[model samples]
Target: MISVAAIDARIWQAIVAGAFVAIGWIVNGWQNRRVAAALRAERTRDVHRALYAEIASCLANLDSPEALAAYRDAMAARMRDDPGFVPLIPRERNDTVFRALVAEIHILPRVTIDPVVSYYSQLFAIEAMIADMRGERFRALEPERRIAMYEDYIALKVQAFHDGHFALRMIDAYATDGRNGAMEEEARITREISAGFDTAGAAARAASRISSPGAVRSGRSPE
Candidate 1:
């Protein structure tokens, strides 16, 4: 027995309530999406920052001529002291970071991408050299053969490390801003990056000197 006017008023109230609820839901969802997008951006930045630093540090370690010489000498000593034992030099590469960046590469700057790609490509070449040197046949070959061929591998590693430093510098250049202390900090970092490249270059030059023709021939030597 409700009046027609009362029925219409109730219907209008229901409709108004539903409309408000819908609007509130949309607003909340939109805000959540914005927050999530921001968090993702921050995470991506963090990943890149960590990746650049790690690659630089790893290259520095690998391109250390003193460390390489020490490792070589240690290996020789171990062979003499324990003929049955073998030691492996630990290899470091930013593979995880690389994959992560590749997954989100669409968001990265094009200039940044090129240097990063070059750095990784160089690393890949160095890795391939290492893999070839560590193959079963390689170990079975004459020790002299190994020594002769290792020069080129060392050269590749050094050059790859040098490229990694270059890539880091490129990234630094792009990220720098003319803010308080930013220029000074960037200059300092650039100097450090340059020093890394110098170390790698020196290592490459030394290895190149030892990359005699005999080494090339040894690559095709019969077991």
Candidate 2:
């Protein structure tokens, strides 16, 4: 013969306890989600920072006046010396950061990912061409063909330089949180520089020179 009022009080107590448990669970879940989001944002920023440094270094090496002059001299030497002479093409062998974080690159902004990937892909292409130039088939090619191949390699490097610029622009935009005019000036400068570099015309000139009556003859095949 328990009183009804006592039973009702117990029921209210249980309800209150259940309500508190639900609120605690909700708060804990919300906290965890907030922390995860923050971590993701931080990781994205870290990727951007590392990639920016690497790309900037590459741009510095490739787009510098000294580098351009060195490349021009090398090509001229190759054209003047034995046609079989392989010009030393400067390229980066270090891609550790990109290789390590490529899988997680998807975590970056959608717009940034493509340009970044494109830049690296161009680098890969350059590497492949370098490898081919060192192979036996390249040595077997005619003098004009060899010049054309070398010209193509230069064109690839130039393309990679442009692609690197695009990647940096995208990264800058993301790092600035999509701020208006964040990379506008840089983009305009890039466009102007790109306009000045005519890869196709240069390649055409090289090919035309080698095709003329008097061209450097191929030397002994590389050992």
Choose the strongest candidate by TM-score: 2
RMSD (Å) of each candidate, 1 decimal: 14.1, 14.1
Model 2 C-alpha lDDT per residue in residues 3-120, reported as the tens digit of each score: 9999999999999999999999999999998777777777776777777667766666565434554775577567658865655544456467899898888787656677789989
Question: Could you tell me the TM-score of candidate 2?
Answer: 0.73
Error of 2 at 205 (Å): 29
TM-score of each: 0.51, 0.73
Task: List runs of model 2 lying over 4 Å from the truth.
Answer: 64-77, 88-91, 178-223
